[model samples]
Target: MKLSDLIAQFITDQLTGQDAVELQRSQLASRFGCAPSQINYVIETRFSPARGFSVESRRGGGGYIRIVRVPMGPSALLQHTVAALGEQVDQSGAQLLLYDLHKAGILGDECFCALKACLGDQALSAVPQPLRPRLRAEMLGAALAALAAEQ
Candidate 1:
């Protein structure tokens, strides 16, 4: 695993069986033998709302970062995924989002594969290259929103 992945896993382990965990950046940085910015990078990317986490930080008195795992049902995950989609998404980005949703047990095997196929380049062939990514984002957001509505 990469250093970032290790750091992410460590933080995750710390949160196991708990709703939230707090840590000092300097301590985590020293433990990981990296800079505090490195810890920040992991927390920012791996513990984002899209991944079902919310982080809060304090800036004084040897500040600490609090990571809270957001409790979410399948519908909630679907809704969050849709909201996380920005104005555009490449094929890989859509795949990663779908994979995350699937791994969370919100999407079954059939649904995951089907969604991935639809988001692939071939599926969007009719869309001009320049417009494909934006179209994919719109398509995905709409699909997820529709699913969320049903749930």
Candidate 2:
């Protein structure tokens, strides 16, 4: 596994049976023999709201990073996710959201993979480059909204 993956796993382990975990950034970096930025990268990519996590951080000598696993019902999760999204969503962001839904048991493996591919870059390749992200966001928003309504 990659260093980032290992770091992410370590942090996730700390959250087992707990809603949240707090760590000093420098200390975590020291434990992994990496820079503080490495910890930040892992937290940003792995613990984002799209993955059902929310993070808070304080910077300074006494600073710490807090990763909170959000527990939400399927319908609520879908609604919250749609609300959290911006005007555009890249393929990776959409995948993150799909993965979160799958993890929450809201989406089956086949459905998740299907949606991922449907919203993927290659599927949108014929569209104009600048327009694809916008179209992707609209498509996902509608799909999630419909899913929420079904719940």
Candidate 3:
């Protein structure tokens, strides 16, 4: 497993029967044999709002990082995914979000395949480099908005 996955799993394991886990970043980094920034990277990429987790950090001698698992319903999950897409999305991120929606039963296999194709690199490659992400986001947003409306 990747270091980030390991860190995320470690934090998840700490959340047994709890809403949140609070720990010192430096301490986690030391335990993982990595820099503090690696901890931050894991928190940012893995424990994001889109992934149903919230992260709060304090910086100081007594600083600590807190990770909370957010309970989200179907509508709220779709909303968070849309918001996370923002104004741009790369193929990989788009694919991941679509997979999440699929796993949540918000999307069927047909819809998943369609959205995946629309957001794939091959489809977006026809667009200019600078504008590809935005175009992908717009297409994805339209599709997700339609899904949200159906909900």
Candidate 4:
């Protein structure tokens, strides 16, 4: 396996049965026989907010990296997912997020269909090509914010 994959798998193993895990980057590098920057790369790529994980790091001698698996509920996960989204998002990513929310019982069938229709490329086809992604992102953000506000 690739070094990054190995590192991600190691962290995944550590995350089982835990809400979060903290480790020293240098220690992980030493354990893997790789440079510390390699650890950073793995964390950045593998533990992304889109993937339902958050990584926070502290610099200096006593600093550590904390990897927290965001709670599985819809509100927290949806907030994290939407907050992490860039100004532009594609259809597949939006669908995946909505699907996750639906499966988690955060969205019912009617709400899911409504949001899916709103996010569809066809629905946004009237907009300029370059602006569609941003529009979709805005719509999603609004929807999520509404959901969050309802609670």
Candidate 5:
């Protein structure tokens, strides 16, 4: 795996419970010998709800970064469901799946928010009509992967 991927895996492995960890971006950046923005990029790209993880960050001095793991429903079954959808999904279908996830308590408020934001109208609005479905599917998949990883 790439160094970033290794670091990301380490961070994920470190997460053991509901309690979140407060990490300093600069510290991590220093450890990895990369820029702080690189750490941000890793968090933004890897720590997402679809992967079973969520991250909350605070700005300014003494700010803490918290990473939390969300549980997965039906073990690996949901992954099959997501894969079946492929790279294209309609709004109704996405909503229905998300609703199911919410009802199951596999997804919490913050997770819902992150998924919504990713699949939200604003993100979808910018895409061309023909590509919107595929983009939405990719976004959903990424978001779900991030959430699933947290578990």
Candidate 6:
């Protein structure tokens, strides 16, 4: 593995439980003798849904980067959901799925809120429209998986 890849693995290894929170990207970059952007690149390229991992980032001071490993069951579900999303997702179907997940207690209120924010019509009204549904699905799936793994 490359140095950055090894460093990323080490960081991932350190996250043992759900309560394990975000890691400082700058700190990780310094530890690996790389730029912060390099760390971001590594995360974007290597820690992806297909690889069974998801990453969340924040900007500005005290910001952090979170990497969550998706459990096998949810990972499979997410894969299937992504495949099923195809080009677009009807709003009603997305809402229904979200409702089902919320009802099942698989997604908590906070997660539900975040997912809604991402999938809300206003948030998705932008260029490259075809990508929104798939992105929302992927984000919701990852967020749910993270919540499940954490609990």
Best by TM-score: 3
lDDT string, candidate 5, 68-140, tens digits? 7655564453564465457777776576667666766777878776776777557678777788778888878
Off by over 4 Å in 6: 17-21, 74-151
lDDT per prediction? 0.87, 0.88, 0.83, 0.84, 0.69, 0.65
- Each model's TM-score, in the order given? 0.70, 0.73, 0.77, 0.63, 0.48, 0.47
lDDT of 2: 0.88
Worst 10 residues of 1 by lDDT: 44-53
User: How displaced is residue 81 in candidate 6, in Å?
Assistant: 7.7
lDDT tens digits, residues 1-151, model 4? 8989999999999999998999999899999999999999888666766467888899889989999987655567767877877798788778876776776677889999999999989898889889988999999998887897675
Over the stretch 18-49, how does candidate 3's per-residue lDDT look in tens digits? 99999999999999999999999888667765
Candidate 3 global lDDT: 0.83
- How many clashes does each candidate structure show, in the order listed? 0, 0, 0, 0, 22, 0
lDDT of 2 by residue, 1-151 (tens): 9999999999999999999999999999999999999999899778876577778899999999998888877887788778877799888878877887788788888988889999999999999989988999999999989988999
Which residues of candidate 1, in runs, are more than 4 Å off? 14-45, 48-50, 54-67
- What would you estimate as the lDDT of candidate 1? 0.87
- Better model by TM-score, 1 or 5? 1
User: What are the per-residue Cα lDDT tens digits for candidate 1 across 1-151?
Assistant: 8999999999999999999999999999999899989999898668865578878899776799999988897788778767767799999878877887787777789988999999999999988999999999999999899888988
Candidate with better TM-score, 3 vs 5: 3
Model 6 Cα displacement at 12 (Å)? 2.3
Candidate 6 matches the true fold with a TM-score of: 0.47
lDDT, candidate 4, equals 0.84
